[model samples]
Target: MEYVEHRMNDEAVKAAASAGLVSPLNILLLSIILYTGYSTFFAKTSYPQLPKPPPPVVFKTYNPHTLLPFNGENGAPIFFAVRGVVFDVTPGRNFYGPGGPYANFAGRDATRGLACGSFDESMLTKDLDGPLDTLADLGPDEMDALRGWEERFTEKYNIIGKFVSMKDFEELGKKE
Candidate 1:
């Protein structure tokens, strides 16, 4: 009986000693380490990953009849009517030189080349010559047709210049 009581007392003493040895300072140190680690990682500021969209495209256009050497009947002109306006396009070429580089007439944007042009800009520039070709006898309708096409074109492209038509061409010769 006494031996059993002594063994139990010894076990109780060992348990008490182990429980008492739980140092508050050690517990505080462990808590601080855990808090610092959590704050440094999970509690800190974070940013989300997102995708970026591509830049917008710009369009370009040219007026017909401002250019030279316009086509006649290798094919007739292709006339376009839109928004109460009329336009005629005759296929041909005009010599570009000096300040007007071939690439610029092609709408290459000089610095950026073909890549700089929009889908419409690039498409329109295909086989297009210069202000001379663009202006060459595209067609003549009522002045209102010119106005509508001009308005539609201006919506897409910047109108850099105007055409000196065949009438002006004859007038120039008469003047000089």
Candidate 2:
């Protein structure tokens, strides 16, 4: 039992067990890994931008409902359109209810335009909150709005196909 060698080769050193304490080599390796992650993630200074949206296109229309439009008085009509999609552009819609208050512009002719403004039951509120609620909560014009909404939202009501247009939406609303 008298064969005590001294120096270990590089291969043997690499195979040696790690010490119970931290080492400079380990710290350097960890720092390198952390820095790589930081540079890849947090240091992202630029990225490929998304395509710019198309320019706005005006397509105005008339609204002759009892409820006033945006920034307009009650019973006054409003109109404005841009980017192929149109909006009431009328301010203070507190007077018009969803279906009749403001005029939404959506087309299905040949362009298959996007779904424009629409009335939904979810927008109703209990009790009156002034003009907004008064118009929104009333049921006097329920028949007209319901009919118009039905025709526009009943074109597409299946999962097997995609929605063709706003005109093709489901008319599964409650029956009168």
Candidate 3:
């Protein structure tokens, strides 16, 4: 009786194996486990290392003429002046660079333009060497508008330098 029962169990096992009891999913999982174990403990592959970044550039003061070259022309960085503060607006190149809507203000004092909410060339200072705009004619509302723009610039861009007149810059150089 015992021999008959053992023979029946052996036949059942052979039938199950022939009928594809081990699924395709089980085979795939086993292959993945083997690959993972081999890669983790036996593979000699190494990942490539990334290069380090360059150092930060030192900021320099700029007068209007000196600042003119940084208007996104000839691959130059974009910079602009606002109320005597020179901001490096390179990150906003899309809006302040060449062919941009506010490109006219790049490398120039944008005080009056921003205060008046105009992007016209007429708003910029006509003479680079001339005295800065006093903004004396601006009403309270205009002044408030200018202040808002200045605040946004301060929050968004780097204050690379101060915008001074040529005369003031020369005086500063002489003092140094």
Candidate 4:
């Protein structure tokens, strides 16, 4: 009778262990389902917003003297004149700023240099008050090259202003 009672007690213990294991598994599955439902039906998802771009720059007129300061010096914007147009080349500061390969053209007329494909200082006009380069001596090939450069400039940089002689600038100021 003692042996029979011991066997019965062992069977009861095994049954309890199995029931405990199944209860935990069922509770885990129920918790997962509840969490899934809560997230799908009630939880709000959010995403970060992007910043707006800056407004367009207003166009201004500049002459050789007035355009001289925008040479990427002292934190100034880089500017260069091409075919009587002043372009804000600040975006290309690495190429047109001080210590740059094309720095000689900054704050000066770059037409002759660009047309001749020369980055020499001689290509730049020395006199600020002097008349603009006529570019009359440029051959057809040079003219075409200059046009190509102008188109590239137009596509890359902002046309911030017009390049004019000091005389013309003065006349414009007087008229205004």
Candidate 5:
């Protein structure tokens, strides 16, 4: 009788396995394990995307008087002009600031001064009017020096705008 009962119990367990039957607790546990494994290995974490930068500001023409405010004094930015191009030299504030070595050149075009190697106040104006024809007297060496300064400015600073010429002003008048 004992042997028969033991054989019947083994048969019952085998029948349950062959029929694909399992307890509700076992099914729930297996589902939880599968979900945890998938989340750890296959799930990706989400992150916030960064915004795009704004466009750059551009100035078509810059007048000498308009360029005066950025002289590295009284909380203004330092700017200088070489040739016909305007450059922002705020990075060299110690040299271009007020009372500095090149302070007189802060608000003006210093093309002639740079060419002649003179920091004279008379050589620092942006006026291209009559009786002020200084650049015309410059020799080859002076012109080369001016070119070198222009190249240095182009390499070092940002070219904000170009100097507005008398011809350009006249053309603007014509357009209107």
Candidate 6:
């Protein structure tokens, strides 16, 4: 009789486990589901990295007289200069075209204006004729701002060429 009773208890425990009632396997399944839910719904994830691009192919140098013609005139591509770097801003013609807010900046190297956060035409200059000391007026904060603009332009646009002074143009013309 004692042996029969022990066997009956064993059978009852096995039946409870098979019925998915309080059992080790059931507890483990619940734990897995909870963990999966927590990870999927609550865990923080980092941003994915962007792919690297190839080096840009730079075109010949450009002067303000040459760069100005691409100002969306008669379906021409719009262009702009920043800190001696020229960008084809045709893609954003509505924002940089004639009569646009930044229209004054389209044909000029407005580095000083950008650095100082001034839209004054006086700050814009295409003639980088003077010595490097011309930029001595910029403070550290202004320089930082200028660097930020250049970085943003590099990331966003295709750099075509650099701005050239009349003196440099003359020298290159003589060479060619």
**Which one wins on TM-score?**
4
Displacement of residue 8 (Cα, Å) in model 2 is: 11
Better of 2 and 6 by TM-score: 6
lDDT by residue (19-88, candidate 5, tens digit) is 6657787789999999999998999977898888644647656566666777888879888777778898
Cα RMSD of all models vs. native, in order, equals 14.8, 17.6, 6.0, 5.9, 6.3, 9.0
Off by over 4 Å in 1: 1-5, 45-176
What tens-digit string does per-residue lDDT give for candidate 2 at 19-96? 523678888899999999999889957778999974554433322121113323354433322221223323323423
Q: What's the TM-score of each model vs. the native?
A: 0.21, 0.20, 0.72, 0.73, 0.61, 0.61
Top model number, lDDT: 4
Error of 2 at 158 (Å): 37
Candidate 5 Cα misplacement greater than 4 A, ranges:
1-55, 126-134, 173-176
* Location of the lowest summed lDDT over 10 successive residues in candidate 5: 125-134
Model 3 regions lying over 4 Å from their true place: 1-57
Return model 4's CA RMSD, one decimal.
Answer: 5.9
Q: For residue 41, what is the lDDT in candidate 5?
A: 95
TM-score of candidate 5 against the unseen true structure: 0.61
Which lDDT tens digits does candidate 3 get at residues 109-161?
99999999999989999898988899999999999999999999999988888
When sorted by TM-score, best at the front, the candidate numbers are 4, 3, 5, 6, 1, 2
Residue 26 miss distance in model 5 (angstroms): 23
In model 2, which range of ten residues has the least summed lDDT? 106-115
Off by over 4 Å in 6: 1-58, 126-133
In model 3, state the lDDT of residue 104: 93
Instruction: Give the clash count for each candidate.
Output: 13, 11, 0, 0, 0, 0
